[model samples]
Target: MCRLSGTKSKKEMIRVVRTPEGEVVIDDTGRKAGRGVYLCRRLSCLEKAYKEHRLERSLKTDVAAEIYEKLRHALL
Candidate 1:
């Protein structure tokens, strides 16, 4: 489900993952071996998540700026 919007449709979402090694990354495959949280495929959700540290809260890891940049590109 989308963390910000509470949307259940994953067809329009992005998978952000916290790997076993504690790395936070965008899971393009959606099958990465780790914990993950979904966010709506909208710039607004991305912005809010970035500013509010929602992904970090959910994944229990620190999300880097580059990952947000990658997510921003993926949304477009």
Candidate 2:
């Protein structure tokens, strides 16, 4: 589910993962080895997650803006 919008449906959401090594990346395959968070597959949800620092809180680490940009590109 999207942390911000509360949207459900795995197929309609994107998974972002924070690896044990502390690297944050989008998990396109959904089988990555790490703690993961889900967000609605929309720019608004992405922006909300970034702006509110929800991703950082959920992953228990800092999330760089560049990673969000990369996610945007992948979603597009």
Candidate 3:
């Protein structure tokens, strides 16, 4: 599900995770360890999550802008 928009389909969302080492990354295989957050495949959703600090709240850590840039590059 998309944590930002509340979209409830796994196939339509991408998983972003914060590793135990405190690195935030895109979880392509969905098997990474650590806290995870979901966002819709759209760039808007990613932006919304970034702008609102939703991912930070969900992962309980500070999210860097580079992470969102990486997501934009990967998703778009």
Q: Which number leads on lDDT? A: 2
Candidate whose TM-score is highest: 1
Alpha-carbon runs more than 4 Å astray in model 3: 1-8
* Whole-model lDDT per candidate: 0.82, 0.84, 0.82
User: Ranking under lDDT, best-scoring first?
Assistant: 2, 1, 3
Cand. 3 TM to true fold: 0.82
Prediction 3 global C-alpha lDDT: 0.82
Task: Please give, for residues 1-76, the per-residue lDDT of candidate 3 as tens digits.
Answer: 3544543666567898999999999898888999887778888888788778899899999888888888899886
Each candidate structure's TM-score, on Cα atoms with residue i matched to residue i, is: 0.85, 0.84, 0.82
For residues 1-76, what per-residue lDDT tens digits would candidate 2 score against the true structure? Answer: 3654544676578888999898999888888999998888778878888888999999999988898898788778
Error of 2 at 6 (Å): 7.8
Against the true structure, what is every candidate's RMSD? 2.1, 2.2, 2.3
lDDT by residue (tens digit), candidate 1, 1-76: 3444643666567898888999888887788999988888879888988888898889888888899899899888
Residue range with the least summed lDDT across 10 consecutive positions in model 3:
1-10
Please report the TM-score between candidate 1 and the true structure.
0.85
